[model samples]
Target: MLLRTERQPSAKRSSGRDTTEKPTRGADVMGKGSVLIFEQDKIVRDVVSSTLARAGLEVHPAAELDAALQAFESGKLDAVILGAASAGDGASELIHAASRVSLEVIVLSSSPTIEEAVAFVKAGASDYLAHPARSPELLGRIERILERRRAREDLRSTRQENLKRHGVASLIGSSPAMQRVLNLVDCITDNHDATVLILGESGTGKDLIAKMIHWSGPRAEGPYMNVTCTTLRDTLLESELFGHERGAFTDAKTQKKGLVELADGGTLFLDEIGDMSLAIQSRLLRFLEERAFRRVGGQADLRVNVRVIAATNRNLEEMVARGEFREDLYFRLNVIPIVMPPLRSRKGDVPLLVRHFMNVFHRELHKPVLEIEPALMGQLEAYNWPGNVRELRNLVERAMVLSTTEVLWSVVRRRSRPEAPSEASFRLPPGGVDFDVLEKDLLSQALEAARGHQARAGELLGLNRDQVRYRMLKYGLNSPAPARGGLALRV
Candidate 1:
């Protein structure tokens, strides 16, 4: 639960040119990072943890530095905060223990004078926080430490991936949805010859799955070809998939190799395979049925060594029923179907995804790591991702670029869901003349349902964001009753 300050000091607004916001979650830092408040004073730990949580960090508090160390090891922390003088007599040993376990250390003092802060920094503390705390600076320090961790891991990963390793293992979270995906990838690893079709909506990371299969497979050393069916014309696609002989078409002035030939001894990924025409599907089916294909405008048949991995956002079964797709070809490609879950379906992955995007944006823009406010994370989990993982990725990337210091709650809140059933289809009762009366009724109904959450309640009503605000003014609804030392949102 969020512990708000009693007798709260109105948070002083900063006048700096840059508007720093609350933090958002960043990349995988290996272990669960927890802040251990070792101050024996209950009030001290409360204040520290409360401050940390307010800044949007995961805090794990212990009264003793020794106990904090134990918890650190037990919880597998990426970093640990040893509250000032809280370690008692074993503070030095505690610091060493932290480094030994590869934990980044931050030493915090309630009354850290200049000398104390310097000494602690010199003594292997990645950060030294002087106790009369400044939320922004402390947040900045934590962000820096996390970024360093990401750079180190990313460097290690780059080296491994250069050797053809599947690297999405760095993506964290023990969500069952993620585990199922990993399991499916494992199943596809041993079946290089078996045709695999990855089915998912856009942004569901079908491309990643295809690459993971290729990189993890026995054919990791071979070429990997990617062809997007939607991006190519039918004639061009045929020439692209199969080699073209000289004078085959106006653009084909000379003999040219196709994706299949280029991908010889490797993996060929056909994205948007459902977009392939029936004629092209027939050719592909023949190749899949008997690993042989003739070049465009050529009489000779050629056999090539390659593994085909097809991905599509379209429902091929529906297309087959409609005669837009060949059922025979669909049967040939469905040898090993791997269906990806949309982001909305995997509630456990939201935190991991937040961190993933955080790390990504922090590096891309060279910004500090930001902690994700719990409130924001909850909002993310509650929202349905109709566009799938791709949609989530885009939102995150945009947030990273546009976000200031805090998680971009405005963007999250501003995001509009797909339109509901059209109002045009629903006729009002006879004599629907009073517009204000109609609006007041709809607004009252929604507000009652959401209990004064303007955003959510607005979604329940078939109205754009502006319309909701305008109607709220038209009705007698307001913000939640204010609580002392908490959010004083405008009604």
Candidate 2:
């Protein structure tokens, strides 16, 4: 029950308005966000409402539980101030109901007890306040709660924006291999703590996959920090990953937080993990296993909630077999594996990728959209993309820059052609060569020369179309050949 205090006499208004009138819904409202004062006692309700209203908050005072619930259900309220007297037998029920909608509920009681407060808090009350609560204290607590809510809303908005920019939707590929990768990403995007290892060759967009996993997942709002393992030596890399205490090393003048520490409640991307030295691999393995690490020369072990997304082009299994990498760490990081296929293996996606890049570059460089030549796609798909998507992106950007006319053409032709093997330079090695290897090399060269035209490739190799096709299948250059007429870029 609330304290029964007499309602103070209304003071005269200088503006000739009635001061005794009750505040109606949506009246005397200001812009600091709305709150409902659900108190049965009119005097207490009016007091709390006036206090909050004076602080620039819109107040909705409800004397009945039904009215309070109706208002709470209909309005965008920052919080609900639930009076125990008004709630009576359904105080806990009301608290739980508000909690289900993520609405903050602050319980007010005349005779506040520790046990009651604990119970209300456990029932999802944001706070439990005593009757005749100090105006400043009540206002302070409400303001703090509102501030936290605003911060969370802001973080959620940011995460949504990042998802739009770096999510799996941004990964453009329709080939079967790319579909597999997308399927895997969808499965793991909501998983917050798994260790993911992305395996692919350089320029295959391994880093892009890492970003997609971070920004599209539950950890989107967390800090995403990436470091290339090959960029630093073992000693410096250790300090960068696990921080250091002051005077830990010659350059450690002050205490520093490493990428792992800084990425707490987020993600840490370790690029080129295969290049990491064996010594550093040991420390990394321990950190992965324990989720704890000590700073250099620091005795205290610090723990962080960070998801480690590691990527590498090197074969970790072979490295482990050769003792260059820790087998334990490989197993730990490989918990969830995503292998990005090389572009040549998925040449069907080349046209789609080319168009995506063209749109991207047009917006970035503010260049007019250039018409693509029909033959360009054929040439692009025919060549073995040693640098993968990154190479393709660069080629598109370069072509857009150098192309003066509206129609994009002949950029592939400008690439330095392989010089023909001359009789003077051709030498049979003293040890002799593998015939299959020589034949495969010649077949690959002829295919490149013909831009993947079977008959044309046969002309270069002095073999018929069927012979060239058979050799191509044997050498695993199994990309479909262009039609006899020509190849056109398809969507």
lDDT per residue (tens digit) for residues 166-254 in model 1: 44575444778778878878877878799999998676788888888887777876788999987777888999999899988887889
Please, what are the lDDT tens digits per residue for candidate 2 over residues 115-178? Answer: 7777777778878778777665677677777877788899899888888888999998999999
| Worst 10 contiguous positions by lDDT, candidate 2 | 482-491
Return the lDDT, model 1, position 386: 56
Best by lDDT: 2
Runs of candidate 1 with Cα error greater than 4 angstroms are 1-159, 162-165, 168-173, 405-407, 415-491
For TM-score, the strongest prediction is 2
Model 1: how far is 203 from its true place, Å?
0.7
Q: What is the lDDT of residue 90 in candidate 1?
A: 70
